[model samples]
Each structure stands twice: as structure tokens, then as C-alpha cells.
Target: MRTVKDAWMMVQSEYRGNKLKLVWASLFSIFYMGYIAFFVGIMMNEIVQSNEGHMAVDIMLLSITPLMGFVLNRSAFKYWSEDSYTRMLVYFKSLPIPATVILCKRKIMSVIAFSINGTLCFGLIYAFSKNMRAEMDLGDYIAFTITWIGYGLIVTGLYITFELLFSGKIYLVLTLAVLIVAFGVAFLVQMGGGNLFLYTILCSQEWGLLSPLMWGTLLVGMASVQVFSKWTIHRLKSRDLL
Candidate 1:
């Protein structure tokens, strides 16, 4: 219980330390998602441009939510890798909090940020778009939002694992290599030239049920957990930050 309390306090401290960045990050997320939704709303409305256009607007808006979520989550990956924060993480591990507990608190902070931005984005879309509650039921929208959050968590976890996998100057090389591989695989999947790759799985089916989005999210999350556990154990053993 005390450990949990300590973890919470640490989270509060970190949040206050980056309060300015948090404000900007929140603004950035809201504005970024708003921009995506606005363009998509325009595209849908222009194509239909009638009462019947409401369905088109709703469809496009809901469909793009996950993609917007993806963009915001990608930004967070880079943010965590920034030098000062990375050093902060090293310092954090030097503290007495349980490793898993600390990691969970960090992830919770991320989820809060993602949720704040996502909700704002959705609110902006609903307010400004023609389909404000027209095409989908509220229940469906809620489910989509939850799934979108799950997607963000999976992406964030994978990137953190990527950072932990390499060390020193080699990490820069590893970062570029990982980005290249990820994008290359994505492009190949987009071009229909890949088989059973992560991107291929993502592009394989619809967004619901046992779709690539959900399953791939689970797979990536599980993989990251395993890799992260190993990495954390090694880091604790070495007691080295860089």
C-alpha cells in the first residue's frame, strides 16, 4: 500500500515537473486531432453535402479516430526518448519503487494524456461535424474509443521496448534501424508485398471483432511486456543508466 502511494506521489511530482510541457502537449494533442477530424469532416461533407451526408461524415470521423490516436501516440514515443526525460527515467530507477509499479504509474500518466487529448478530439469532431450523433449509436462510439485507447497503449509499449533493447551510441543506430524497418514493412504491406508481417496484419481486415487492429495490438503489447521485463531485469542487474 505504501509502495502504491509512493508511486502515485512520484507520478504527481513528474507531472508537476513537466506541467508546462503537459499543457502544451495537451494543446498539441487537441489541436492535432482537431485538424485531422476537420479535414476528414470536410472530405465527407463535400462528397455528400446533404442530409444524407450525415452518415458519410459519421463514418469517416469514427474511422479516422484510431488513426488520429496513432499519430498522437507516435509523438509520445519521441517525447519519452528525449534526452532529459530519458535521464529522468534513469534517475527514477535509482529510487526505491518497485520496477513494475513504477512502470505502471508511468503508463497510467500516458493513458491520462491520451484520454484527455482523445476526448477533446472527439468532442471537437462532434461539435463541428455534420454527423454529430447521426450515424453511430453512442454505445458503438464508446466501444470504438476504448479500442482506440488500447491501440495507443500497444504502440507506446512497443516503442519503449525498442528504446530499452539497445544501449549507448548504438541506440541511435538501433532507433533509425527500427524506424526504417517499421516503415519499410508498413510500405510493403501497403503495397501488398508482405505476408503475415505486423503491418500486413494491420491492413488485413476490418477494425472490429477479431480484426488486425485488436489482435495486432494484443500481440505487440504481449511482446513488449516480455521484452521489457527482460530488459528491466538486466538494467537493474547492471545498475547502469547509459
Candidate 2:
């Protein structure tokens, strides 16, 4: 309990004075979702649902929440890597916590962020369901949301590992550009996996049995995150912090 509290404080500390950014971000989420619910939803309903291809666009949008989270998570390691000049590293290291614990907390934060986005994404889908004339019911909605989160966990591990490897003292713009390209390519790959997962989930609903493959995929995703967390800690122990 105490460790969780400490980690929460560490995460919150990053936002020390970034009030405006937080407010604006929250506002943007609200407005973007509201616009989708009212306007986009209505227009999207016009499309006749003939084939599974009708859901391609929605699945693509659903993938973005985690892809963005993966990039956003780099901020944590970016700060850690810049500790020599930033000196914020000293404060974090001085805590009784190990480097791995700090990273675990960051991963937790990423999951939480993705959870909120997934919830909103689910809401957006349901809002437009009638318009899109979606055939999915409430149970399918729950499964989809939970499955996306598992996928997000896998994505978070993969991207953060890459971030820790390539991150260094470089121009922020260049770094972002590199990440944008990388994320774009990765999103393409993830979309393929998500498409398969979604189709399976939709089909299995008729039989009222989610296949073991789905559960296995979720387990693989969870394991990837756990393994990578340990990998990050091992790497951290060997590196010197400024």
C-alpha cells in the first residue's frame, strides 16, 4: 500500500505545474468524443452494413489509443535518460525505491491512461452503434474493451523497450519525428492483429464461447509486459545514472 502511494506521488510529480496542458487535454477529449457522438455518429449510420469491412474504420480508430500511449510513455524514460543535465534523476534515485519499481509505476500509469481512452472509445462506438447499425450487443462491448486493453499492454511493453534503447540527448523534434514514423509502422502491424482479434470476438459471440485463442493472446500480452519490465530493470541496474 505504501509503495503504491509513493509511486502515485512520483507519477503526479511529473505534472507539478502543467495544469494548462492537463486541462486542455481533458477538454479536447471531451469535445472530440462529443463531436463523434453527435455528428459523426449520425453520418456513419448511413452506411449499409453488408460486410465485415464496414467495421474496419472503427477498429483502426480503436488501435490508436494504445499506439499513442506507447509514444507518450517515452516521456518517463526520456526524463530518466536526461538525468545528467536535468538532475531530476537525483531526486528519484535518492528515494528508497529501485529503478525497476519506478518503471513499474510508469507502466501502471500507461495502463490507467489506456483504460480511460478505451472506455471513451467504447462509448464512442456505442453512441454511433445505432447509426452504424452495429450488430454487437453489451456483452461484446465489454469483451472488446477488455481485449483492447490486453493488446495495449503488449504494445506498451514493445514501444517502451524500443524507447529505452534509442532514447538519448537529441532534439525533441527529431526524436518525435523518429517515434512518429516508428509508431505509424507499428500501428499498421497492430491493426492487422486487432482486425483478427475483433473478427474472432464477433464470431464467437454467436456460440457464446470466447475461444481459448483469445485468452491465450491476452495472456501473451500480459506476459510480454511482465517480461519487459524485468528486462528494463536488469538494464537499468547496469547503466550509470547522472
Q: Candidate 1 regions off by >4 Å?
A: 1-3, 16-22, 40-82, 95-98, 126-128, 131-133, 163-236
| Candidate 1 per-residue C-alpha lDDT over 1-242 given as tens digits, one digit per residue, 9 for 90 to 100 | 77557767876875587777667666777777788667755554344334222233333432343333232443345543564335655766667456666655655555565667667765665455565345434544444445555554555554454444434345456546645554554455445633222222133223435455555665675566557655664665555557
Q: Which 10-residue window in model 2 sums to the lowest lDDT?
A: 47-56
Q: Give stretches of model 2 more than 4 Å off.
A: 15-21, 31-48, 52-65, 68-91, 94-97, 131-133, 168-198, 201-204, 207-214, 240-242
The CA lDDT of each predicted structure is 0.51, 0.55
Error of 2 at 180 (Å): 11
lDDT of 2 by residue, 209-240 (tens): 37454465568778987788778777766555
- For model 2 the local lDDT of residue 183 reads 52
Model 2 residue 54 CA deviation in Å: 7.5
